[model samples]
Target: MYQLAPNIDLLFTEAGDAPDRVRAAAAAGFNAVEMWGPTGKDIPALKEALEETGVQLTAQLAEPRMQFMIPPKDHAPFYTGLDAGVEVAQQLGCSRIVVGSGTGFGGRKRQDQLDELIEIFTRGVAHIEGSGITLVLEPVNIRVDHPGALLDRTSEAVYVAKGVNSPNFGILYDLYHSTVEGEDVAAELANAGDLVKYVQVADAPGRGEPGSGSIDWPARFADLRNSGYTGPIGLEYYPTIDSAKSVRRIQELVAGR
Candidate 1:
């Protein structure tokens, strides 16, 4: 079955509750939903929603929002959060979680910071290697969305994943960010190949629905499939129109249902 990962936080504003987002995605033909840190999630309610709506939690990002690709002085707290996220992932019946890099522009040497980041993620992989959950590091575009973010290039992200050197670690290649960063999506994705665990997208000009912006989504998605990415394609963009309208349009554009 084809899996579409809906961003509940961005999808069902009309429904108002987190569970309602899951219901909306399920009703709209999506089999999975991905969420940010488990901050406001109610486990029982989420479980009920999943059972009732038949939608699975495909992924959830870890909390506290520190840089994993650039080491900070207090990485233990971040590690603890990853450990907790693993337990949460186990609860949600998911085997993946996003590991975010911190804010842009640290007053430190680039190579030194990069080394520290590798060490932190290496330790993080060790902590969760026994578990089935995989930690995916995202490389945000410093040019448009985030300025001075450490992990910008696809090559750099691949390096980090290889440096971590565990099945539990990988990278998320978000198409919108890659477009903004001027990386050839097809080529970069082809290079990443099976190392990429998740993919997120939005239109280029407006960062809205896939077909409404400047991105040649059809070709890109074809490349994605051809490159052997069989995982859920994450609709992580902010809504340009009303949530329902935008989602419906995206469904027509991407899912053809």
Candidate 2:
């Protein structure tokens, strides 16, 4: 069965704080949960809640708010932040970290920026070589959410991951972003192949729960299965109703797939 990990960062906001959200997710029947960043959260309380609830911390953002991969000169700060991120992930027992290509550099050639990104991730992979941590690059949507984001297309992200050429480095196949970018989801998944390590989903048009928009959930999941991705599919959506109720349809959809 495909594990559905609710993104606590966006889903359970009504639960007050991080620990409460973690408890809420566990009470709602999720065995695993993901979040955006570790900073500003009560780490001890969050860890206690997870330990008590027996919920696995699946993934979190690496170097939140730092665009170290944007310019070659910024790599130093990125590594420093990555070291902190790795320590946080280890403390939370998470094995995956989400990375984003920062906005395109002004007046610099696109290929030049891409080459710098590849070089940055190659060094990052070497840093975490034996840490059992995988850094997954995410291509966010520029049209709807993130304007000027460098890696908006899945194909481009795949190319960068291929250039890195490390088992520790992979791409985050976010269905909502792909749909927003107007890419054929199945074809992109096939193109990504085994380089895809993480998945996140919300519906197109509105970043709501699965059934709230036009995404063909069954076909997408079928494509995911065909592509040999067996990792957790993150429900990183904003719920229009109660979070638990919003995800029921998706749970059924995933089960039927």
* Top-lDDT structure, candidate number: 2
Q: How far is candidate 1 from the true structure (C-alpha RMSD, Å)?
A: 2.1
Model 1 TM-score on a 0 to 1 scale = 0.92
Off by over 4 Å in 1: 68-72, 104-107, 255-257
What TM-score would every model get versus the actual structure?
A: 0.92, 0.95
lDDT of 1 by residue, 1-257 (tens): 24768788787767768888788778777778888778887877877888887787878888778854443356778878888888878877877888866754467776666666678788888887788988898888887778867778887788778878887788898888889889988789888878898888788866787767888766777778778888877778888777667766656656533
- lDDT computed for candidate 2: 0.88
Candidate that would win on TM-score? 2
Give the alpha carbon lDDT tens digit for every residue of 1-257 in model 2.
78888998888888889989999989888899999989888888988999999999888998655564443455677788788889888888999999888888777887887887898899988987788899999999999999988889998899899999999899999999999999998899999999999999999889999989999989888989999999998889989889978978888998983
